[model samples]
Target: MAKLTKKQKEAHAKIDKSKSYDLAAASSLVKEITNVKFDASVDIAIRLGVDPRKANQMVRGVVTLPHGTGKDVKVLALVTPDKEAEAKEAGADYVGLDEYLQKIKNGWTDVDVIITLPSVMGKLGPLGRILGPRGLMPNPKTGTVTMDVAKAVQEVKAGKIDFKVDKTGIVHAAIGKVSFDAEKIAENAKEILQTVIKLKPTTAKGTYLRSIHISSTMSPAVIVDVKTV
Candidate 1:
């Protein structure tokens, strides 16, 4: 092995001590340059440095999770008799019909994700306010309102990742962990970067992607080279 420089030695040492993808190296970088005291989230967030005052720069979108939610996201699909079998074939935990709308309304909190055929939203009434804040409402723009029940269930089971810009115009999502091989994690990270790159709004001026960083669930984000990305 080539002799390690002091900086490289320190960087690797931080990651080694972190056990999981705590993103220690990224935190070390912030401490080194900014001298800002921070925990993992703040440490990772500072790198975004996106001006929150400007709403247009925010990055937000949704992606089908490849590994399903780390937690079982019980999927419920609202469909007609014609579509029930397809929904079942697609792995819906519960295949509901228009009639069950009342039953679901009575027991709304029990559901995790809701998939509705194009016709079901009418029955939802004003409950969107209740579901919207929790991000449970199925909106057409996000590809939630559709008749394709099987695909919806499969995507949910595979850990569909969601990215939304925070107050600082930063988008973050959980891809996996350091326990995963470096190549796999890097690949997942790259996919996220690519998604964000494509999501850059044409209306937004200035640099669409101000910067790109990768961080594990509890780690600091390290600024990755976007040019190579």
Candidate 2:
């Protein structure tokens, strides 16, 4: 095994691996351990007791973090010429139709979120192999495919994020940056936790939320008490 650096060892020393912390305490501890120079992202990992393979047990939803994600979210709006101005005015980083579609075809998925109208979805069908894998494909359920291009772009810019349980039954997401106040980090974590609780699949048996953990981009994971969440 690789040796831990002095900073890494110090960070680990401050954490009690045997004890689970409340949301607030976990959030604060994560900030105390983050020693990266750049603003490291504060991430939350939730393990659910549902079988992701089962159709009825699928958990997916969107949540707008109360304090907003500290990172700048880049949004791409693929719409007709008529809606180009609307998307641009709403803070979309890239806007257009054919040219952008061709760019995507050539494996140019440099944007974070992709928003397009229902009419334009047909044109994107062939490019699913490129977009689907990158999580850039616009979907109606996630509000990424809609006629309201402006509203979608604005929401994404304001910290709206969509998440789904992975095959391993773990839902991972970045809540905010370590630079944010401990209270802000806790609030963001709570917002996502509450939202996840609300999305519990009816068919899921046993404990819905099995475990929860919070950590910074380069810090040790802090286990969060399921009861306090």
List the candidate 2 regions with Cα displacement exceeding 4 Å. Answer: none
User: Model 2 residue 207 lDDT?
Assistant: 95
For candidate 1, lDDT tens digit of each residue in 9-93?
5554554333323233433343333222332222122224345566665666777534332455787788888889998898888
C-alpha local distance difference test of each model = 0.60, 0.94
TM-score of each: 0.66, 0.99
Looking at model 1, residue 24 earns an lDDT score of: 36
**Once model 1 is optimally superposed onto the true structure by TM-score, how far is the C-alpha of residue 17 displaced, in angstroms?**
14
lDDT of 2: 0.94
The lDDT, on a scale of 0 to 1, for candidate 1 is 0.60
* Total clashing pairs for each candidate: 10, 0
Residue 175 lDDT in candidate 1: 59
**TM-score (C-alpha) between model 2 and the true structure:** 0.99
